[model samples]
Target: MQGKALPGFRDFYPEELALRNHIFAVWRSVARRYGFEEYDGPPLEPLEIYTQKSGEEIVEQLYAFEDKGGRKVALRPEMTPTLARMVGERAQALKKPIRWFAIPQLFRYERQQRGRLREHFQLNMDVIGEAGPAADAEVMAAALDIMRAFGLGPAEVRLRISDRRVVVAKLRHSHHVAADELVPVLAALDKWERAPADSERLLTDALRADRARVRPVLEFMSGLRDGAAELRESAAAEPLNECVQRLGAMGLGPFVEVDFTIVRGLAYYTGIVFELFDQGRSLRAICGGGRYDDLIKAIAGVDLPCVGFGMGDVVLGELLKDRAKQPEAPAQLDAFLVAVSGEDVEPVLKLAHELRDQGVAVEYGLRHAAIRKQLELAAARGAPRAVIVGPDERAASEVVVRDLNAGTEEKVPVARLLNGFFR
Candidate 1:
């Protein structure tokens, strides 16, 4: 038997890391385009942080343990807790509606699935002071544009959105559901899509009322599926309607929709919630977030309105791979320097150094090797061009540059080579 990475962990070799880096680059670029500055926090935080936000039972899914100092700590499973803490500490000093982003490697002790890993990097972008529907549109737009940057179109992914608070209000006002029963009923709605029977069961159990009383609630839930017009007219759904219009005005209307089923599973989401899923429904959510208006206040005693989303690299990378949107790993070097003979080594080293200092990626064999072997090595390393330094060229202060792929050679003076080839 051979040793391997832990069951849910991953080992990213060079080629694999290229894809990860590409995702990060696109994440940062898209985030910056939205004026969201990057930020970070420690990977480890007090275990109470997680417990406080999600309750003690959440420890079962967290990589939690006590340290030598007897302080319980855990790898952060999500960025919102840390963001809440950080924002709370400086809420008074910082500007309103803080626009910040972080690419954090989150860890969780959970069963492995296609897109769910033990550890993965996630892009967290949050607006921490705005409560308007426009802020929701902005965060949603950032998530959508990142997918767009990877060449994914609206056809590949769609943002299914819902507002738990608004829906709860509508249910309470129209269906006569009590405020005490909202959470369980909302949970039912969250699962209503895949398990309508289970949802009905849960809702009935929570309500303890007859099926006649629950009929309106179920109709309300059903209306969310394809009832954009009717629901949009309701005052309870005005914020969501405004958000839809905002996205439409921005031309991202085609990428998003209204679906009350997206309660986000987490209890913190208080306003418009959404999850981006593949059009084919073949994977877990590629991204998910929504308004957590009071979470900051509850966690850190700072009541900053916040809207954000977390897009994990694991599911996204899988989605990109499936769509063939991932870029191929970059080739090794811009040029490889090969010495024709022992006497030509010094000039080759000098030119290689100079070229490197000039910002060109250049590589050469460390020990003396045959010219043929050197060129072979260059090709093996995927160098596009090879600079052959022979006695004749060295004597003439020139070098022969061979295009590895084109199989053509050209001679240029060492002084002019930089300007000609690199330019």
Candidate 2:
């Protein structure tokens, strides 16, 4: 039978793995610098956990099934729900404002495209037990720090910030939309940038379809963007005024701007939503998060106001590639030992190991090949120095070192070779 692989799945070869590791290392370093302790959970969890928090709508987007024991299970599509569950499991013992970060492999059953994969890695950062604007600021700062660490400046990305509370309150106060219909309209707003005309049509249709129910919500969004002058003319401007003040106090007012349009796709968010986007808005969100103050209490029966953000590795990688700043090929080894004759192999191997033990990345020529071939291989591997141990050199208890880049050669006593390299 002919064999074929899945369309959206991919395999990582050695070179690709090296690059991925490099990117992950940078993420780890940045997370550590911000004092975020790393934590992890199982890749598989009960399906009901996600359904409970994200709603069954998420089930259509997840890879879920019933196990042999008939227990519904799912591969995690994101980490926040799992984090919430874990914190709930130990709510009484944990400290406040728990700072944690994790890089987990998340799976989603979605159409694969550039920067969107069925399987990908995401860096999640969360601050629990605090609901103040400062907690929100810190999370936003960390997200910005990550982008800067990747050499991205404000011009490369912008954090579009909004308050879900403001969204709801404005909708109810100005447009009088019912609570039940809020979520679907918000989901549509989240897609506005990608499908502007369609989103407008959907919003308009939703409002006309249920004017009494949806008009207030539409009016609220309109007021948020353009009706602000008119709102100043009205008396119910406290919420919008407070939102602006809080954003300023958080010191994120410049990096952030009110995007009445930013409705994060997830249903769990309760307040203060924001998303990071490329300057050109040509790609998906690089990161996004909002307040889920009631999630911990609802899930674990312990109340904690938590805010966090998830930065997916895939989109960031694409951004780096587009900027022509992807990590370069890793440095080659310092030395390569070439045994000119089969008899010299043992000594070459011994010397190679000794150099490695002395903190040098060294490799020994293993194939049975001529001296010229071995030297060619060393050059191709980008070895800065080549160590040639021939029968004559062995008899004299000496070795020859050739500086590949400089084309310089010297003979040194075998025992002094280590000292010479170290020097």
Candidate 3:
């Protein structure tokens, strides 16, 4: 019986794998340069750990079940909760200001669409145990640096910066909304830009009892722009203003803007928040993060200030394609050994293995194909040079080296071939 694969999931062919590896290599290089230690967690974790931090709303969006032992578990939807649990487990002994990063295959049960899937990879970067606004700026700068590394300029993407503290402060000071009611209110306000006018009004009314209290909330909502001047005048705009100036002083202001409408949907975010958006607004957030100063203590029972962000491989890949930057060139192998006839196969395989042992990526022609066909295959497989082991070469203990690009060939003794080809 033939079976079809599920939607929103994909199998990576060799070509696709090469592209994925190339993208990941760039990510790793930039992450290391910024001093983030690589980290990872189990693909599955206790269901309660996610539910505890993400709330019941996440249950509908997660692939969760009970094992045979009746222990509840779920595929990890995100890595922050796992990071918190891991750090909490060793909170007492671990040093402060832990800088960590991970690229994990995350799964979600939500419906799939452009730039999203039931399963995808995400790069998570976090800085733990630093609470100051500078810490927030540093995280933002790191994210911006990654985008710039991918060739995204200020015109291509902008970091929409906001502050949950400013949102909370506005709700409490301007609207007199109780602390208990703030989360839902902010969740509603987060969609104010996209929601219908009536729907936004209904949400605003639910948060504020008096029309006077609601005025500032509406004004703050209206003041959402790409400038700092208007943001400073709004009641719910202080934290965002502070963030703007900090990023500006660091010369990162050009890449960022104040957008009070960018209330991140995550519940744990407690301070500065931002989301990177394509200039066209043609897709969802390319990356996003915020301060979660209470997260470490909430999970590990130890107080620590932390900020970080996650960039999914899917959306960024789309953006890269849109920008015409997806790499078309495959990685090259050092050499492909072409065996001209059946009798030449063993020697060809032996030479390939020897080259591999010396740290060269080498492939041997498995089938006894024609010399022309073998060379074509080598070129197609992105081998820069081809080593021809014909009957004459085998008898003379020599190999013919051909540069595919330069279209040049030379004969060298077997003893000197390795160094000759490599050097």
For each candidate, the alpha-carbon lDDT, in order, equals: 0.89, 0.78, 0.81
Most TM-score-accurate candidate:
1
Against the true structure, candidate 3 reaches a TM-score of 0.89
Give per-residue CA lDDT, model 1, range 273-298, as digits (tens): 99999999899999999998989999
lDDT by residue (195-292, candidate 3, tens digit) is 74754666656765566666666666666554446446776665566667877887877888776677775667887888999998998899989988
Candidate scoring better on lDDT of 1 and 2? 1
Inter-residue clash pairs, candidate 3: none
Residue-by-residue lDDT tens digits, candidate 2, 233-260: 4334344345455656755466666666
- Which residue pairs clash in candidate 1? 97-129
Off by over 4 Å in 1: 418-420
Q: Which of 2 and 3 is ahead in TM-score?
A: 3
Give the candidate number with the greatest lDDT.
1
Query: Which residue runs of candidate 2 sit more than 4 Å off their true CA positions?
Result: 1-5, 208-255, 420-423
Candidate 3 segments exceeding 4 Å error: 175-181, 204-216, 226-230, 233-246, 328-330, 341-343, 391-397
In angstroms, how far off is 318's CA in candidate 1?
0.4
lDDT of 1 at 71: 98
The TM-score of predicted model 1 comes to: 0.95
